[model samples]
Target: VAIMGRNKKTLDEAKSKLGNGAVAHQGDVTKFDDLDALYAKVDDKLGKIDVLVVNAGGLTAAPFDQVDEAIFDSMSDLNFKGAFFTIQKALPFLNDGASIILIASIAQSLGFPGMSVYGATKAAVRSLSRTLSAELADRGIRVNTISPGPVETPIYGRIGVPESQIDGMKDQFREKPLLKRFGEASEIGTVAVFLASSDSSFIVGEEIIVDGGIVNI
Candidate 1:
């Protein structure tokens, strides 16, 4: 497995946890040149990429009236443009039957306050996954998305809210979810693993929601 992100310590920790099966690289998702360099290193070491998970994205929440052009552009540039380019740059290194899993959010379909720009970017990702699946079908590469809801990660703390307010927001999220709890990163990781493996061989261009039934009901 090859991991790409800005957090070198986190990536190193993940690599240690995965033992010898993982390789860690520090790169920004927003830069195609950085990704290309990482891809080159991976190719030299791993030969080819069999699975590409475009999972780098963040939420920038603000009231619609307060959202400025720079804010919207930053969110879209990182979430959609970065994701699109990651796949594009990895195409040459990807094996024919490679699986490409894009990480999206249930916010894309759900009406949530202070999430319009973030949700729009996720919606674009979902749309791209479907279109790319069809476009890459002839090459036997499958493109799909896992739209997760309220996963308990560092992102929750960075939702443009005070730390004091996060617990209350989390409580409300749990109550609203049918499962009565926020999802774990591992849950989304499991879905991603399945999508990247032959277990989901017949599935393509589908947005699998691992949202604890928050969006379905």
Candidate 2:
């Protein structure tokens, strides 16, 4: 497995932790040249890839009034445009029968306060999966989106949610989701593994929501 991110330290640590010939490259996903370089390295080292996961994205929580051109561009560039080119540039390196998974968010369906821009970005990701699935169907490529709801990650703090509140945030996070609890990263990983493997061979252009039943409610 290979990982690419802007943080060299994080990438190195992840590579070290996932020591099964995993490699890490530092690059900004929003840059095409960086993505090209990353893929060049992949092509030279791993040749054709069977599974590609595009998890490069960001989230913002602010009222619609706060949505400005800069905010829109930043979010769209990273979440939508980045995902688009990440796959476009990887087309050559991707194996014909491979699976591509995109990490989206429950924000796509949720009407949470201050989530207009973020939600719209994820909605684009969800829509891309469908169109890409049809566009690549003849090539045997599967494109799907995974919408994770309130997963346990360090992102909340980055989003300016105070740690004190984060501790008890889950209880009042949302009133839906039959599971009544936040999801674990590993749970999402398990589902991703299933989607990437032949087990989901028949599944295509579909969304596998990993949000503890958030949208279903």
Candidate 3:
């Protein structure tokens, strides 16, 4: 297993938790040079890729009226452009039957406050999956997306939520899902694993929503 991130410390920590089989590559997905280096390292260390997950992104929240040019560009650069180039750069290194899983979000389907730019970027990713699947079908490579809801992760804290209001925010998120709880990180990982495996061979160009009925119910 190989992981890439812009932060060395967090990358190292995740790599340690992933065990000895996992390797960490420090690179920013937004930079083409960095992506090239990452795939080069992957080819040198592990050979052709079997599974490619374009999962590097973050949430930047602001009302449409208050969103500045910097915010707009930042969201587009990290979420949309980064995902596009990551897959493009990996083409040569990907095996013929490789699985490509893009991490979208339920935000793409719903209108949430302060998420206009963020949501639009995710929507673009979902669209990319459909088009790419058709383009790569001749090569036997499957491209799909997983749109997760409110998963339990450190993302909330990183998003500038006040400490005192964090629990309240979580409560609101829990209520959005019919399951009445936040999704575990492991649950999302399980879905990704299934998509990566041959079990989902026929499930191409589809977005498997793992949102606990938030979108459907």
Candidate 4:
């Protein structure tokens, strides 16, 4: 497995955790030059990759009226543009039967407050999966999106927002999901692995929502 990230410490830690089966490449997905260099290195080392998961993004939200261009560009570049280019650059290095999984969110359809821009970025990813799956079908490369709901990540604390508001949002999120709890990272990982395996051979261009029935109920 080849894992790429911007932080060297995090990359190294991931490499250590995966043992000898993983290789870490430090690069920022937002930069085309960085992606090119990373893929060149990957090509030299592995020739081709069997699975590509685009997970380089963050949560940035603000009310439509308060959202500035800087915030807009920051989220767009990392969430959409970066993701698009990552897949594009990986084309030459993607094996014929490779599976491409794009990470999206339930926010795309939730119409949550202050999430318009962030939701738009995720909506674009879901749309991209449809077109990309069709484009890569002839090559047997399946493309899909994993739309997760409120996973137990430390993102709320990182977002530049008040503690009370964040806590309130979390409370509302917790009460709404039928599961009555946030999803674990491992739950998402299992879905990803299934999508990358032959188990999902017939599932192409589908956006699988692993959000504990949040969207439905």
Error of 2 at 156 (Å): 0.4
lDDT (10s digit) by residue, model 4, range 72-185:
999999999999999999999999999999999998978988888899999999999999999999999999999999888878788778999988888988898888888999
Highest-scoring model, TM-score: 4
Task: Please report how far candidate 3 places residue 41 from its true position, in Å.
Answer: 0.5
Would you list the clashing residue pairs of candidate 3? none
Roughly what TM-score does model 3 have, to 2 decimal places?
A: 0.96
Structure candidate 4, residue pairs in collision: none
RMSD of candidate 1 to the true fold?
A: 1.1
Q: Give per-residue CA lDDT, model 3, range 1-217, as digits (tens).
A: 9999988999999998999878799989998999999999889988999999999899877778989999899889999999999999999999999999999999999988888999999999999999999999989999999999989888888765466667886788888778999899899999999999989888999998998898998
In candidate 1, which residue pairs get closer than 3 Å at backbone N, Cα or C atoms, i.e. clash?
Answer: none
RMSD of each: 1.1, 1.7, 1.3, 0.9
lDDT of 2 by residue, 132-168 (tens): 9999998999999899999888787776446676565
| TM accuracy, model 1 | 0.96
Candidate 2, superposed: residue stretches over 4 Å from native: 161-169
Q: Give the TM-score of each candidate.
A: 0.96, 0.94, 0.96, 0.97
Task: Write one digit per residue (lDDT tens) for candidate 1, span 63-154.
Answer: 89999998899899899999999999999999999999999999899878888999999999999999999999999999999999888788
> Which of candidates 1 and 2 is the stronger one according to TM-score?
1
